[model samples]
Target: MTQHLANFKARPVACVTGATRGIGRDIALHLAAQGYDIAFGFRDEIHASNLQEELVALGAKVFCQPLNLFDAKSINSFFDSLNTAQFGLDLLVNNAGITKDNLLAMMSQEELEQVIHVNLIAPILCAQAALKIMLPQKQGCIINMSSISATKPNPGQTNYAASKAGIEGFTRALAVEVARKNIRVNCIAPGIIETDMVSDLLKGNEQQAKSKLLSKRLGKPRDISALVAYLASQQAEFISGEVFNVNGGMLLR
Candidate 1:
């Protein structure tokens, strides 16, 4: 048992939210391949279970739990359970986010608050929870997912943009607060990725969107996942409090 505990402590762990699909799923898989045990939370139990099996098959110990981003109680319970797990957390990837796009004039209060709760509030809470464990260990890495919309807003995306912009600001501020403790915080702003979440946005304007990208193609989850892996690695130890863009050159700012 002592040897087993030592082995468990030797392997790094990563907790990824909304990790059953899209960019979140890719990040979890990429990290598992890099030898990190995975702990993931998702709203869909069946999907999360299947993903757990897949990750386990990849030779990484996997943990899956239910998460309701709308519920603060649920978020707290998740981190509490994670802190008790055998694998110690060394990285956190806040990949879960939602967008309710509508012109401000037509947007209902419910829509605005829901988007803000999931995109901005929940991530902030998760980061706080992770810091509880990370600070004691004197090391950890946090990667928050932002979007191109955060900087370049399109019509009918005011709430979405605002929430993401908050993510960038929070990431920067938190990085400073935790840098002295050996914790690195960073943000990623992805451009038009070909995920189901954005399928509608690309429906009739696929060609038009492609034209705007210097790469002339939509970004893939792998593109973002690769960068995430780099940031979580020791090579990026000097990098923190910065936002990296994987937008296929769609925006130059």
Candidate 2:
């Protein structure tokens, strides 16, 4: 069950996956601050518990549980757990992803499948479930997280690139199908952000990372989270089926 404010019963609700840390964690906090009740999936209770406390402090109702993105049933169960009648599902953010970097010649079959399943398939299933709830309400927004790698491939990230590319395509096509229902789908392509997921690439070399971007600075989690907040708000009602690149002008071509 979720802990909530007394008057939270009427607030908008959003479900964000892979929210235990990094971009996902910040997005959840940002949404809560913006007055949206929050729901998220996690693999670690410690992280989930900490996040729950943070959300509650922001006057938000939180629905969170352990989630295994590789399993379809698990994904469905996460969405099912939300109380659609009481709070309403207004936004879905598919921000969970993984990267197993290795040269294609040395990459394992298992590696490819794991990355693809979590990064790509998981979001498709999430959208499928969220759409079921949104279509009926005739008002919802789905924001899929993609990466610059989807367009500008990096060495030893073939699987990661493929998965993210699929997400971009998925957002566009799905947005068209649900546009008439007033449900908008959009994708975000973040350049290299300073998060644990990509800390290895950053590796205490802020100057080096900044050198590669036109902004001459590494992107922060809040950079992406800010756009997410806008995209989920009424101000972005007219925006959909598009991808916003938040990589400080990183070269994608």
Candidate 3:
């Protein structure tokens, strides 16, 4: 704790999307513990309140708001509030995403569009907003939450995989564009994390999932959060436009 305080005289601010639960919540808390003022969005007011209390307890200045990723207006409004509140975001974590599982043949247009809207389009918009603030400061970090599915997708995840793959490409392009400006962009590809997002999938197949990974264990939200903290720090100042795999070696045999 003391070390974290020593690292920053003034706490940096981070805006995280989909922070009501699961990995997003964990990322918000982890950044708070590291002495960052947290500004996060949620679809549920109840979840937002709970997370606000927790972040406040950690000595972080917390700003919680309702966000609808499906609506472009809502995305714009979120950043508007952040700017109005003078939070001056130093980090933006594009962790808000949804999965609408279905094969190409069975998938409805609405379902596919919804997934793409939330998972891919929202991040691009948020990054655009954050840059307005960051470019002036000439320092900021943006971490997009990608997935292992982008490369090794499972059945019925066409929409999810495509959105994640888009994020990787966006991360690379943006990183290069912002390199000279001192802003950084990166992506995190998590595999089979033990979050509510996949609780059902892991219920009866825990052992089966474990057997496939060299670590023989599922990844945790904390696992990804720790890496996010590092990337946001000076240690990773030279690192950008890279997609990091945090899947307990799930990609390997």
Candidate 4:
């Protein structure tokens, strides 16, 4: 049984974390247009408002909430709010993450802990909460955002890469657990996408980055969002427990 707003026609619901910018924002927009009422979490108030307005304009019911990835209460409270609204969430996109890059020897304890907590632990917690909703419904999809760094690790990104690697592992294990329940779990590992998160590195090394990619250009947010939409759809019902790389062939398996 799909979830619906109390007074409106049934619309599949999606809850996305870190939807204020970059790939997260693009996914929210794309899903809203795809006929899913979107309930999103964001750290930035202004950007969240803009996203809410846009989603409404797209003719979708929008639930925008503040999220502090660092705080467990905030994460659970957000899901609680979603459940209270009766959105009947059909998808959860764990797209929020941060990078604190430094050589392991040079990285501070705070940097290491915060990076792992925000990038890895937060998504797991979000999924745990979402399952409370999904399992009972007998239908749902979870799409986690990992990075190519997980496999093709660079020197200073030990923490970032490790966190993403953990996410990939979590996806596989969780997928197996819930596959029998008709709930799918999958992860997407993106290449160097053109987003604010990687702006500084992409700026000076544009040519260097392009040379390595078979696509010869940096990825746009839409590249990742497009795949996210596909994985959330019925066509991908057979796909789960897999990590899809959207890295422009940056590191081929």
Candidate 5:
């Protein structure tokens, strides 16, 4: 029965950062249905425990590790644990990130650094760790969760935009370098998704935001999850170094 839902019975092992909530949680669940054993990183212990329970119910071999992406020591320790476990990681989803919104003029240096460290540097570090294992096997897929804000600037999101834009640059360069090793790198830039993180923004202004979308509605978590699942699958073998926009046609380019 589960085999029908998941096309692959072999079941790839995937690691997803920020899998406790929002888009990351959805991605983890969706991949589990597609027969992936999941190793996830989370900031909050309570949330991580809850997510592990849910994934376990779905019969997924889930590993929920507490990770602070902003801290280099934490990042190194988490990867070291994975290595000691002898888990051959196949798909790496760099979904852990944060936003410190403020106008460029008013944004503090600390705020800027915090956003950059989580959104940009963290992904780079996670990818580097994944590459250490993947390069040897000559196979892997990496999906970095980016934002449409990377291209379409938001008034108070200068720091966020810059960090996301940096992911695009990282994706392209890393894809080229690792193509020979059979490792594929790509990005997903979502716009106005209906997640817990952004529910406040959409609560009373759903109509106004919908007006800006060609689809006439905010994107759902499942919308992005489906794409992530496809990209992680063998169906996307030829695709690499591309930023897929799941934005309800918000940016037409």
Candidate 6:
């Protein structure tokens, strides 16, 4: 039994979307360090290749696929490519997301649709595909990347907030449906993480942003990655349908 347990702990397969950079990239690297083979999907070929190289250097079996979350066909095709004998995934991280920052008054239909499609719908589709594979094994972990904006309304991020809020709701509902199969689903709501996507905002209003946080500092990608690694591990097996806030005390609730 001890030998069997050791074999089980050797390596696990994990798939992370939007892993070319930012929070997703960090999560991918963190998981690899924890003995998980890495498979990530990204829209940019150049960025995806770079990330693949980094993961390979970490001694992980890494596969990077070009996937457009906005395109439903592409999303399905990407997963199909992963449904292979040697690539059975034990963990799925739905981290692919986009933000079209504009007040509701100025938001166009195209803007709202794009955000919803990528942030909410794409994750749902990916989760659905993952569930089919996980059900047979009766074990898997799914982590959805949400945001504090989902709960706290911000002026220019109406579409982003709504999409993230939708993910929160989806996480809770799906967790209940899949718990019987030993599939745990949860979300991580990150607040003001220092990433390339928000470099401009941080650079332009560093002082104002720092003052707003109780921690008096922005969150780092590693901070979020640590929480994600825990939730994906056996250490958090009893945790499900929960939303973790890593926002530097930005939201009390």
The alpha-carbon RMSD values of the candidates against the true structure, listed in the order shown, are 3.4, 2.0, 4.3, 3.4, 4.4, 5.2
Looking at candidate 4, what is the lDDT of residue 114?
A: 99
Q: Give candidate 4's TM-score.
A: 0.95
Per-candidate TM-scores read 0.95, 0.94, 0.95, 0.95, 0.94, 0.93
lDDT of 4 by residue, 10-37 (tens): 7888888888888898999998899888
Residue 34 of model 3: what lDDT? 95
Instruction: Mark the regions of model 4 whose C-alpha exceeds 4 Å error after superposition.
Output: 1-9
**Model 1 clashing residue pairs (backbone):** none
lDDT of 2 by residue, 166-236 (tens): 99999999999999999999999999898876786767787877888888878999999999999988899
Candidate that beats the other on lDDT, 1 or 5, i.e. the better one: 1
Candidate 5 residues lying further than 4 Å off, grouped into runs, are 1-10
Candidate 1 weakest ten by summed lDDT: 1-10
**Tens-digit lDDT track of model 5 for 19-127:** 8889899999998888888887776777877777777788788665667887888887777776656677889999878888999999999999999999999999999
Q: Candidate 5: lDDT over CA atoms?
A: 0.85
Off by over 4 Å in 3: 1-9
lDDT of 1 at 136: 88
lDDT scores of the candidates, listed in order: 0.87, 0.88, 0.87, 0.88, 0.85, 0.84
In model 3, the clashing pairs are none
Where does candidate 2 stray beyond 4 Å? 1-8, 83-86
Which digits, one per residue and each the tens of the lDDT, describe model 6 over residues 1-253?
A: 0000112234788889888889999999998888888877766777777777777788787766667887778777766766744357699999988888998898899998999999999999999887767888899999999998998978989899989999999999999999999999999999999998788766779878778789998999999888988998889999999999989888853
CA shift of 141, model 2, Å:
0.1
